[model samples]
Structure formats: structure tokens, C-alpha cells
Target: MGYHFKFEKIMSVKEREKNEALSAYNDSVKRFEEVAEKLYELLKKKEDLESYQSMKLVSGLPVLEIRHHQQFIVNLQKSIEQYQKMVQNARNHMLFQQEKLMHKNIEVKKFVKMKEKGLHEFLEEVKHVEAKQMDDISIQHFVHRGS
Candidate 1:
């Protein structure tokens, strides 16, 4: 007899759900990396600007120009802060989605293992039946030969 799992459909649905959850988690990770890279680039720009401002100090630039540079630095800092938040939120979302994916994976694995175990038992039963039939046929052949 063919081995059949009663909950095979449910297992398949759970497998699909796991795949979707994994994709969502991967997207979240990508978004977090993008925001983090933007933040890192912004910080590097601020450092370079500071270096330029130090060079201007030796030449004694105008006060207005100094103020403008400082304002730009402040704006950059704010942008970095916002991007940091976005990265953090994305990280949190990735973690949540990962948890969901893990659960779905476990659910599907449980059913798959159960089905495998059932199939193993079914194959063993078939082997036993086949062996008994072989023995019965061999005994009948021997008895006819003796007669």
C-alpha cells in the first residue's frame, strides 16, 4: 500500500508560509543594511567637513561661512539620527520575521518527520508480508516435489 500522510496539505501550506516569512526577513535585513550604510556615509562626510573647517581656521574665514558650515553639520547629524532609527526599526522587524519563519519551519519539519516515520513502518510491514509469502511458496514447491 502506498504511504499517505493525512496532514500533507497542511504541511505544504506551512512550508510556503515559512518561505514567505524568510523572504520578508531577508528584505528587512537588506533595508537595515542600506540605512546603516547611509548613516555611515553621512558620518564620514561630517568627519571630512570637520577636517576642512580646521584647515579654514588657520586662514581665519568669515563668521557667516563658519555658521553655515556648523549648520550643515547639525543637519547632517539630524539626518544620521533619523537613519539610525530606521535601521533600528528594520533590525527589530527582521528579528520578528525570523522568529515567525523559525516557527513555521518547525511546524513543517514536525509533519515531515511524522510522515517519514509512517512510511518507514509501512515499508517494514510490506517486507514482512513479502517474506511470509515467499516462505509459503517455497514450502508448497518442496511438498509437491516429495509427493
Candidate 2:
């Protein structure tokens, strides 16, 4: 007879769960990266605007134009703050997903180890039975020859 693991179904279930967790983790990472990139772009734009505003000031730009620049800069700062919060939230979610994936991986490994141990025991039992049958045959052969 072939070796059969009693927890084969459970092992299969665990493997499926691991795959789902991995997919979720990947999605979280992607979202986090997108949010971070947006934050970087926002910071770069703010820097460029501040630099241009400084250059314009030295070139004797009108007071009205200066006010407009200041207003736009304030709006940009508010947006940057909101984006920063979004980035932080995304990072937290990614970390949570990573932790979940790790747990699923550990569970799958445990089931795999149990299956390996069970198979090893089954093989050992098969070997022991074969050896006993061989000894019985040898004794029978010797007795028949003597008779």
C-alpha cells in the first residue's frame, strides 16, 4: 500500500492560505510605494516653487504676484501634510500585511514538517514488516529442508 498522510487536506488548506496572504502582502506593498512616490513628487514640486519664488522676489516682482505665490505655497503645504498622513497609513497597512504573511508561512512550514515526519515513520514501519517476513521465510525453508 502507498503511504498516506492523515493531514493532507489540512496541509493543502494551509498552502492555499499562505498563497492568499502573499498576494495581500504584495498588494499592500504596491499601495505603499505609490503613496510614497506621490509624497516625493509633492516635496519636489514644493522645493521648485520656493526656489522660483525667491528668484522672482530678487527680480522685483509685484506685491500682488508675491501674495499669489504665497497663497499657492500654503495650499501646497496643506496638500503635502495630507499626503504625508496617507503615506504613513499605507506603511502601517503594509507592515500589518507582512506580519500576516509571515504567520501563514510559519503555519505552512509546520504542516509540511509534520507530513515529512509521518512519511518517515510509515517507511520505517514498512521496512520492519519486510524484515520480519524475510526471517519467517528463512526459518520455514530450513525446517522443510531438514524434514
- Specify the highest-TM-score model's number: 2
How well does candidate 1 match the true structure in TM-score terms? Answer: 0.91
Task: List model 1 lDDT by residue over 25-142, tens digit each.
Answer: 8898888888889989999999999999999989998999999999999999999899888888888988898898888889888989999998898899999999999999999999
- Give candidate 2 regions above 4 Å deviation: none
User: All models: lDDT?
Assistant: 0.90, 0.95
* Candidate 1 ranges with C-alpha deviation above 4 Å: none
User: In order, how many clashes per candidate?
Assistant: 0, 0
